[model samples]
Target: MMRVKHGSFNHVEVVEEMIFAINVGYKVNDLCTRCSTSQLSQSRRFPFLRPVRFLTDSRDVLWIMDTSEPQIDGPDPSPAVDHGLLAELESLRQSHQSLRSRSAEMEETLLLAQRQREDCVNEIANMSKIIESLCSERDRLASRVGELEELLKEKEDKFLSKFEEELIERESMRVEIEVYKKKFESVEEEMEERGGLLSRSMEAVQTVKDGLIKVIQNVDDDKIPETLGDENGGNGDLRLDSEFMPVFEQIMEVRKLVDLADSKVSEYKEMKGKEKRQLENSVVSLTEENRDISSLLRVALMEKEAVEKSLNKLKGNTEQKRVALLQFAERGLQRVGFGFMMGSGGSIEQPMVESYGASSTGSKSDGSECEEEVVSLASTVEKIMKNLRLEITQLRRCLDESRSDNERLESLTTKQAQQISENSLYIKELEERERLLAQNIEELLVDIKETETEVDRWREACELEVVAGKNEVEERDKVVTILQQELEKTKSALEISNGKLKLKADLAAAAMAAQATAEKSLQLADSRATGLRERIEELTRQLEEADSRERSGRRSIMRICWPWRAFIKVNAGNGAAPRFPNVRRMLPEMQSLLHSRV
Candidate 1:
């Protein structure tokens, strides 16, 4: 019996060896038949070949080799063999050698198959390792994407906060602009009041000047009458001159006061004009600043809108990428057969069980790890998608709020622009009015200068008239002394010559007529002196009143100036105009008084 081990030969090689051995047995059988017919003794010496049994190692299966003759116990046969038997033995030996070579070839083929199977297993292990690395890379990329999304959210939040802050600043600027407008309005009203006051004061000064001219005219008319009066009027003329000297001095003082007041008024007017120009410039600058601020706000809003659009586009791309990644993951799962495993349910479980029976526990553990990783990655992706959705919603809400704020800001800017335009127009109107007022002031100044020249001319004429009246008074005094001496000599002659009674009587009648005329002239001079004294007293009183009024006007102007100074300081600081409530109330009363005087 021949035994074949399991590792040494496979089933195909063992079968092939058995078949070859069977054929050799058949040849031997045929040779024995021929030998049996030719030589019976030889056939008896070498009996027909019996069946050969082959024992397999593990199965312990017995393969019996069949032969044409049975085995027989006999003595040694002859060494000499027939030619036919020798030829048959030689053919069987060649066939055996061929079978041995074919068996070696079969062993080589079996070894090649086993080696190919080992190579396929190694390739599968390498593919699984590559799949694991790819999954790990995908997971890392997903984490990086999540970090980028978080950074995007942070950046969006910061941008939103900055936009909100800008909106607040815009609102503050709008409020400040409104405040500036109110201040401008108040300042304009104050300027108007000041202009009215100046007009009223000018009117008052004109009326005072007219009254002074009338007083001067009255003094000139009274002086002409004093120069024409009788000898008794000389003493009265001297008394009038003494009284009128003080009135003339008072007139000079009043003229000085009027000039001072005029100068102060002109200075005040110049100051007001300068302040008005400054205010206009400030307003224009403020308007320009407001326009620039509005433009900047518009730019900021546009940038915010652009950022919102970019964020929306990024969100859309991220969503598309997420969906694509999810689809790719689904396809990967399908390619990895996980999708079939999930879809096939119990049918798939049976295959898995069979695979588990055939494959090692290590393969089952790898599949479980892959499934766990897929589930975890999917859950993480779902969570990330949810977070992205929430962030997108928040960004949309922020965009809506920003849009509303932008609309409000735009409205505010429009309103501010309108207000600025209106203010500019008002300023233009004020400028026109100021131009007209300046023209009027120039005319007034010219009239005042002309009146001053006239006053100086009149003063010189009055001084010359006073000097001529003084010389005429001295001549009248000398003539009155001569008349008194002649009258005494005539009375002595009447006393000595009693014979010329008729002549003495005629001289007495003439002297009496002259005496009556002299008394009438003396009475007229006394009345003229009383009238001149009353006129002088009235002129003095009027001058005093004018001086007092001028002082009051100066005081009021000083008060106005102080407030203006304060206003300038405040305006320089914050562009606010000053309020003069007291001055504004007082102006109307001054206007009324000036109107009454006029």
Candidate 2:
């Protein structure tokens, strides 16, 4: 910086190296127009202030101070550097803002996914309830089928037992019938022999009657004696007499035979009574057996039909349960699929199970339904198995894809955060530069105020010296007047006596020397007053410069406070001045204080 005088004004101003000072015979164009930095040594002129840099380094030209006229142009940049680093900083700020917005969007999406997952869980619970109901219904149906089958089997057993009993009874009755036929034949044979004997006896009696009739007819009173004598043929003779005796014996024998026949007939009548009772008992027993067999047959036929119908119903229920399982099993798949049902479109049914594979039938196609036995059913079994390999593979693939997408997104977010953190560090350095500038300005203000107070004190001292010089001049004038009066008296006396003239002249010389010394003192006082006034004016100009620096710093304070207000408010109250300290040292203290308060 160089000083120059222009009119009565004295103050500092800034000038560019590109411009020349025509009045001062100085060419600034020779100085480096493309300044390497935005700061210079203002300390060369102002010793009270610490050296400091410009507000920012984006400018390419130099900082120049001129005490001549204030320059029109502001801190202008060099043509060589172009737009500098400002454009790059702007682009980074925009990208950081976008990353923050994207992170917010991701949070919202995650919330929606959580809601959908909850809904799926509720749906799964309801499905489990449905499955439980179906299982209970199936169990009930199976029990019913089992009961019907048992009833049918019991009926069959009863029918078989009764039928066997009836068969034994029929065989006994057939043997009895054969015995009766043989008895009838024997009785007929006896009757035929008796009839033959009776016929023979009748023939003999007829011959004897004919002989007796002839004897009676021929033997009137005259023939009677001769007939008797001749009939005895020798009845009168001894041989005749023996013949009549033999006839009497034969008559006795016939009487004995008739008595024997009477006893035999009584024995036969008792035997016939006993045989008739036995025949009646056999017939009654057979009729009772038939009735029982018929009743059992009717009951068995009813049970058979009931069993068939129950089996048909059980079959239908099995089909329904299988279908319900299929519907409930297909749903949102989870990882690994072990916690839930997973199956393909071809779901298992009861018919495919090993235990249930064989179909049931109570009758042959050509046989009577009434003769059929009960169908068999077993209740304690599960009958369906689903295959799930295909479905699980599909779910696994989807989960893999989703996991990959999430990993990539996380990596992108971390990179963006790193960039924003780097930018924040640069901003911290800029803040530090601004704090130094404020401190330098304050020191300059303090120095200017001190100088102004000193100038005032010096001017007062000069005014006092001038007043003393004026008093001396007035006393000298009084002394000179007195000396002149005395000289005139001496001259008058010399006329009376010429010898006193030399003494009066000596008094006059001493008064003239005092007056010249007083005039020189007045001249010295005027020069000192002029010098004090000039110093006061210089102090005033320096103060004006300090005021301008303060005003510019005030403008920056409004804008810069935005980033630091929270920090300032927490560390110091709003009424106090904001301080910028090295964050590393301050952080520990702030943390300790906050912890103590908490």
Best by TM-score: 1
Q: What local lDDT does model 2 show for residue 585?
A: 50
Tens-place lDDT per residue, model 2, 136-185, is 54354345435534543554465456446645765664465456445445
- Give the clashing residue pairs of candidate 2, or none: 13-66, 232-235, 234-237
Candidate 2 ranges beyond 4 A from true positions: 1-86, 97-105, 108-112, 178-598
**How many angstroms is residue 531 displaced in model 2 relative to the true structure, after the best TM-score fit?**
99
Q: What local lDDT does model 2 show for residue 88?
A: 36
- Pairs of colliding residues, candidate 1: 51-65, 52-65
TM-score of each: 0.27, 0.19
lDDT of 2: 0.39
